[model samples]
Target: MRNPSRTMLYSAAGIATAFILVVAVNIIAGALYVRGDLTADRVFTLSDSTKKIISEINAPVHIRFYYSKNNPQTPGNIKSFASRVEDLLEEYRMASHGVLKIEKLDPAPYSDAEDSATMEGIESQLLSSGERIYCGMSISCLDKSQNLPFLSPQKENLLEYEITRAIWDVTHDVRKTVGVISALPVLGMNKVQPTAESIASGKFAPPGPWIPFKELEDTYEIRKIPLDAESIGSDINLLLLVQPVGMSAKCMLAVDQYLLRGGRLIVMLDPVSLYSIVKSATDPSYRETVSCNLPAFLNAWGIKFNNNIVVADMTFATRIDMPQTKITYPSILDITSKGINRSNTVTALLEKIGLVFAGFFEFTEGATLKKEVLIHSTADSMPVSSFLANRPEMLVRNFSPSGKVFDMAVILRGDFKTAFPDAGKNLLRKSISSNSAVVLVADTDFLFNDVCVQFSKDQFGRKFYVRKNDNVSFLHNLVGYLSGDNTMINIRGRQTITRPFLRIGALKSKSEQEYKNKILDLEKDLIQTQEKINNLQKENSGRYSKYVFSPEQQTELRKFQEKSVAARKELKNLRKGLYGSIDRIENTLKWLNISLVPAIVIIVGLSWAAAVRRRSSSK
Candidate 1:
């Protein structure tokens, strides 16, 4: 009751002190990084293999970020973006359990460290003349002898992955064994394949996920074999088989036994080939084409290969020429994004990927199957004869009139028991029984080099894009998914669409030279006709030169005019006969580009992204 003013003063001072403490904590929190993963589907989330590498780090890791905070490239406007990048790295550091450290360095006063960033492959563009800007990073593992991939600290979205992968690689030694055997060469030098040299030379080409596995000579031992080779090694963790043509029954059985031993298997078969150089327009090489139908293990797993055909619809087709809307026949088979499953890891985060020249498979209901169509034909698709695989001539409107849809591609799987009655036994050793699951695909042409090369240009006067099919991606995911182990050790990659120019066709020898000679003959005929018309006009130059007239000169002009007109008409007809619509091919491609590719991308991109995200989240 005494001294009320003094009591009030004391309460006010206490309130002020609490407020100051709160403000101080907020500032420190802003400086420090915490995790805020709002993404419903963690596509940007660390892959299982990647996560394993990071969790296994036994020593402390340090990452130094070298970015000029005041540089033109690091404008105040984009500083928020930079801060986000900084925060992401901090999250990795936090995830590392005090084993990760990050140091921010503002390159000061023409430092030599700035030069090192460029040499380490951190790309920077010039914001102004003579003013170059770079954002660089160096990752150090506690171990001195381990190898790590270089990373750009500046990029957004991928910053977390970049930093974490680099840290894991440098900190821990990756030592997992993978085995490969395929019709398409990847584990070997691949010189026997078409783009082998280009792929080998690292010509800025798209990388197949299998390349890293092939390059693991220093860490893990790699074993290779032909499709016909029998008996896979027992110690192999993953086995790959691609486009096995005329493999002996024993070889196929060997693969089956390997899987029976709980070994991972990836089989890439095809219903029909889109790009086959089978000696002619009518080559009978369906040996692999028809034979690749997965006979035993597929049905055992409750999956079905219809051995049918697929055709595209107007809704899903990509146009090669818009004015003419010349679309590529069979070249563009539209798959509904619904074909992708949100529950599967392989395609959960996939987007509108162009599997240029692919086939689909279907599943039966008899077995305990969890069937997911990774890619499917649109409702507008219909079945065509497999006989038409190489018929480029069928790429016209007449071939695909309207209204036809069918299912083409599928990914079928489940806790498959076995195709063989006694499948529990191992491939090389009878003591071990197989518990490994099976994953199979019905397309093989997409894996070949020529099918994947950018063979033509686009309508924008740009080279057409050719992203090598996820042939290798499909294989790597198959093994990783089936194994239930994240240490597969070789699946970090990016692929972009490719564009190629038409200026580099091969020179023809005699037989093909004869075709060009025929074209030359047609050209000569056209020239002669043009010359004759010119000469005829010269004689009557005064009257018919401009050719504006009344009736007065009718008789005199008749004979000359009739001959000139007839010659012109004949030459036009002859040109049409020789070239047919071949000349229109270029124009058609232009039209297709304008009308088809963009529309296809938009429709597919939106639909596909939604489904892809769904799948990614479940994984």
Candidate 2:
């Protein structure tokens, strides 16, 4: 037999040993800066771009993080986000090899810390209870400083990118210049002539620059290039061409020469530009053009863009709810991860992009340039007439899957040959090297402010724009990559924190498709029935009055009514089945979550007890 005192002593010693081991491991981990990130995307792990930026820092950078930790009125979510910010900053500090210093400050009301935070331009969040909280950071490198007024939780995916950009900004001295050439007023209206009636009514106001243009201005110097300019300035770092319509031959040659001389270019073409239509509605002088393209340049480069045709994808159709009915507008695409090329750094982190009446590109035979598609439509896509883009209902009714994938965006890299080979000897005939690149996007309306963002006001009545999707980020990434700021491109728009149930999503999509097909069949039958009724009435025109229906007409009408009722019943059943299936799956998941761990624990406990009993009997 065993002594009870000895058994108690052994148990106590084992517990003590486990506690000591946990403490020692934690201490060693802290000292050695060791961590494990088991997430699939490694969200907690620092990106290679971030590591590279941190490693190159020779000057000491000081980061001051201010949070109202002592304020009881501070929100719980803000506190949690602040903790995450601290952890991320700690990681940065560790990676910087002592060059990055972080100081955490909790500013109380009317304290010196608060005053310091205010001086650094940190924005304070005012609560409903008349209290203020601070959750911002200020980074300084020698004399240069950058302030992030507030760290918004909604922009969590961009947290690392923002921090790295702040560090880079303070260290860098020069800002690159971007040249903008757009048929639309992207840089705001140049001159607004006040009409006599508007002057009397005091209601005339010229539109401002696009939101994306303003965002670009914050990071780079934006130069407006005229459409009729003879040459593109050499000082322009990157050329942004949006809706290149009404450009003279000389201007086209200038753009071609710019590309041939190793200049980076991003062109945005559209089969149907809704923005132009809207502008025409407001400004009578604005000429409305449904399509725009750089035909001369694209044809020479062995890329074909049909300005009269718009891409329609059933798989990526965006559903729009109208006042009368709901429609899945095939012309308006919502490209998801499957369509975005994940291997490309410029588009890897972007989740979704919205495009209106977008076009597609095709590579001609014997194309010499190396081409990579950044975004494409699904196989269930086809080209439709641009004229039908304004009529969503008709477009949906006539849309058919072509079973061919179309390229929406592409990156071409090579030594581009001049489109104007017969031009004067002063211009470049070919690129100096094979490193030049040009990015082409099929749609330009996605960058419009109304399509990509929504207006919102804060508690202090300050206006801000909230992103509707990743369209703005996609543009930023393109600009960053082309301008050789690859570090920021890598870290921007990282993996989303929400892990969706893809299986459930697939099931839902399948069910919705089935229901839609049924509805289409019903509509077709209704149309046929109406046609038959009309034919019968024509045949019996002399035999029956207008109000009184003949036997054959009455029979057809009754049959149509019965079919409509049956369709309604079938639709109801389909909706019920869809919800029922989802509910069943959710319940099963809930049960597993509640019982699985406890069940495993009980089984292990019983197994260990039985083993101990057997060992005791053997002894």
Candidate 3:
């Protein structure tokens, strides 16, 4: 009923006022708040170790972000992936209750604080426009005594572990040390195999990269020795036993004492030595060999190694070229990338890798067991005889794969009393209150040189190929997990190292085979159609001149040409789909985001609105 012009002006004024109020409130809240994003599924996040370390943060964690809001040289480096680094750090603050503090600093071109960030190791690559920008973050606990330089979150799918690990290392008191023992050099593995003469001549040749033990120096302390049972102690946190040959009775007893005292160990024992072709290739009538047995100690702890049976799986079989033009792929004990435990911390961030000549273990009756199958072969796997005298042929068939796979590698956990109850009495050590801890891997070939490597020496006298430890991400995870605190074990989230297939499932083997055959048949048809189109013109070669003159011939040629064009278009679409799944996956991720981010936002808003209404009523 009032003046129209006055009403319009009032409406406009109200909108403007609300905008100002929102901006002012946001600014005030931001001063004391840090922000992070969980929108990315493949974001660089913190590792479980790092997460635990952050959770234990008693003092506030201060973060000063130095970024160029407007980068001149790179034009839009401010929009680069580095911004995600800020988002991740904010996540840490959100998880940290007021203990984590965050601050943002926009350094001017000629500012002293910018120089300080640079001096503190926050590096920035200069761009062409002569504009220098701040591109990283610095975290400090207490003084700069514990400073973390985080430049950018990683751009990989599984980068959270590395980011978190760096944070943990910087935030924690000291890095945990893992103890390693093997016949091979721990790190600095040679690309080329040292001649047998090298080991015999004492030249000290390191093992290859694929030899699972490569790169031990970066993450652990390698205690290279011939371990007898008596040497396990509190000084050693994790013991890695790789193909221990002739471990003296004294050494075995020492190991028993160590486990009895509640120590952890990773044992790799092979059923037979496929380690050296130089060692056994010439024995045409080779028998199976059993390499490692805990004898009595393993049994006492409810862990038993049946060193006699060789595991053969159908799904993950390896193709070995045998002597009789035998290029048949035996369900030859392969524990490739597909075989690793996907949900476990040790095997999560891994791809395809393989193992060979593996053994299996059983828990003795009445043995307390917390068992996890760390590695297994395909469904078409079974046991072959495991003796040096038995020919490898028992497992070697004409690629007749059946889906009979079994566990070649396992992780056994529980309180283990020493095989010799009196063994630890010498040192006067009591069993752990909850009983001591230990780890056992039945197959030594899992870490050997040949099984983990592929080699080709070049004319330039260099040898190189895929490294066995290329698959060692899981191994490193295992090392980090066992030696580390449990809180750190699942800092981010706990995923399995291996996933169990639905053995009793709705999908049968025949259905799987038919599905495969259908795809193959479609591919064949596509190929045949293309070939027919190419030959159509050739089929008319005899009457080339006549056909060129004939109306009927010309009409038929036009039909063929049109049909061929349509077929080509269809083929192109199919090819593009192979590379287009990622886009579809991303779209699906976006659609599913409603299940995560949007829901959180709505809940928070509703709760805030409810609180505001309640306060107004009270007033």
Candidate 4:
């Protein structure tokens, strides 16, 4: 007995209210910068450094992201990556607080956007359907523009860093100048006297400016400072001393004063640099023993340095070719994350760092400077004297592992006192005003090209470099941090996408070790049996007669062969069992991940429904 018109009007009013509320909610969401990141690593979240960089921008910066989205020719992966890029760009816009403006363009063929993209030198890839797809971004500030050309999906880990760095570079107009002070050929010492054979062969160039120097040149201006040079150039933003040897008092004073005056310093001292061996091997006049020391300067900075000792780590030794065969040299340490200082910005994101014939350091008594160790040797590390360290053969013969940790690198930051307090005009400051920092690395060979890069030549005779480690990134991050570009400071080397199960990994390693031991034992037995057979044949051999084996030798051979077959079968079984165990674990994890949550939800829902029915029945 209700009025139909009145009921219909009330229903219409309710529908209208619901629609209005939905529209209002959508508008509010669109206006706000709100996103819930459910990713485990929070990969979509902007880092604090990125947020700071965006917030510090005083001028407007335009970021044009050109992507071919929903195109029939574009790959699905590229489209997905473009969506991620868009999300990141949106995050940046939100963080910038209206300073950053982003524009997304589809740049259709023959369109004005396409023409603009071409003019900006953005690289385009031709799809399988003959349609060219663009997936690059360009950032501009005032008159300065930086183009990424092509944003490679393979380099997604470094995408955020690259974008931030480009924006920083465009906004900041000056490139830092670095001064190099080293006796170990960083500036590529030209031959004072050239040989006639070298001239004829067209290989008569300098020994090297070294590979690390060449890499640094792409970022900073490297000016060579001689040991005899009395003063460091005022224009030098950072001072790098590599394998510094035979430095005079004046040179030491200049360095001390430079650091006191707010100049950044990177000191690399080697107990025995391997590069020096190669350099001196060719020239008799070149010093066979290369060591550097600034005792007074170091003592003043509250650091105790020993140029006569080398750190040898058994747990982290790198295998290298020595004379006739490859052997693991304890003096050549490969420092992993266990040795790296994660709290410091310089070594935080670095994965592996290689050092050759490195030295170790310790803090002196009553030290004033604040010390932070950036690299550490394992508990299985010990120090070897410089004399034994210089000879590679001695390292193989005499080196013994000592279960003790050693400091490989350290950063000291504090107001430092003058090394020569009484010397007038020679001392710059008795006490430095602002807190200055200097990083001390225990090895010089970490910068060597052979250790850090793999040089290759293509079919067309073009040479290119493939980086072997994150050394270059580490160096850049350190230099950038020292130069006050905090945007690049927190950037890690690269993100690793895949994470393994530790329990499974441990099981696999243990099984593999056991299998290896069994194989080695079987191989030893086989070798002994072969030797016995050979001896029997040699003892019975005659010039025109047949080579015969004794019954004992034959019996031993049969036994060894049987043992070998048994070992092979055992190895095969071990491998199969190892894989089976791994597969079972993986399958169990997969099943749990796929069903546990849904099963819990169903159980909870059923329990609630049963409780509600029981309550109704009780009522």
Winning candidate number (lDDT): 2
User: What residue runs in model 3 are displaced by over 4 Å at the alpha carbon?
Assistant: 1-55, 64-70, 75-78, 103-114, 123-137, 143-163, 174-176, 187-230, 246-248, 270-358, 363-378, 384-405, 413-434, 442-473, 476-481, 491-619
lDDT of 3 at 293: 67
Per-residue lDDT of model 4, residues 1-619, tens digit only: 7799998999999999999999999999988857997876666677777777777788999999998775777877788888889888998888898899999988789989899899988877876567788888999999999888777665677688778877876777778898988877767876567899988998887676666677566456788888778999889888888777877788888888888888888888887777777768886554633677778878888788888899876556665645733354668777777789998778786777888888887889999888889889987667888777645444644545577788988888888777877769676577785857888888878887887777875322335455566666766777777766546656546544444475774464344334434444544565675676566677768876446556876776577667766756765565576468878888999999999999999999999999999998897
The per-model lDDT (C-alpha) reads 0.52, 0.83, 0.55, 0.76
Instruction: Please provide TM-scores, in order, for all candidate models, with all chains considered together.
Output: 0.56, 0.83, 0.54, 0.70
lDDT of 1 by residue, 1-619 (tens): 4588997899899999999999998998877754555554444445565556667877777777766677754555346665666766765665667766777766644777666555455545345445655456777765442222222222243445445446655765654566767544345443333377786777734434334343334344467776677687877877766656566667777876677667777666665554333422564453344435656766767665644443433333443444711224444532224444445666554433344444555556766756555555554445555555444235332344345334344444445455556544433433233355445665655444544334444221223333334443444455556555435323332222233223211111111223433444444555665665565556556854564444645544565456656656665565455345445655777898798988998999999999999998897
Estimate, for each residue in 519-543, the C-alpha lDDT of model 3 and write its tens digit. 3344456566566655665665675
Residue 600, model 2, lDDT: 100
lDDT of 3 at 159: 34
Candidate of highest TM-score: 2
Better of 1 and 3 by TM-score: 1
* Clashes by residue pair, model 4: 188-208, 188-209, 379-404
When superposed on Cα atoms, how far off is each prediction in RMSD? 15.2, 5.3, 11.9, 7.4
Off by over 4 Å in 4: 1-34, 39-41, 126-131, 182-230, 244-253, 260-262, 270-338, 342-358, 364-370, 383-403, 414-434, 444-473, 493-547, 550-619
Q: What is the Cα-based lDDT of residue 515 in candidate 1?
A: 41
Residue-level lDDT tens digits of model 2 in 1-619: 7899999999999999999999999898877855689998888878888899888887999999999988898988888989889889989988898999999998898899999999999999889898889999999999999999988776676689779888988887889999988888888986888889999998988878898788777678899999898999988899999997888788888888888777899999988888887877876545545578777778777899999899987777877657833467778888888799999989988888999999999999998888999999998778988888767656666667788999999999876888776777756665446578999999999999988888887554456667777888899899989988777776766645566565665565455555666555655665676676577667666744653676776887788767767766775665577557777887988899999999999999999999999998898
Summing lDDT over every window of 10 consecutive residues in candidate 3, give the lowest-scoring window: 504-513
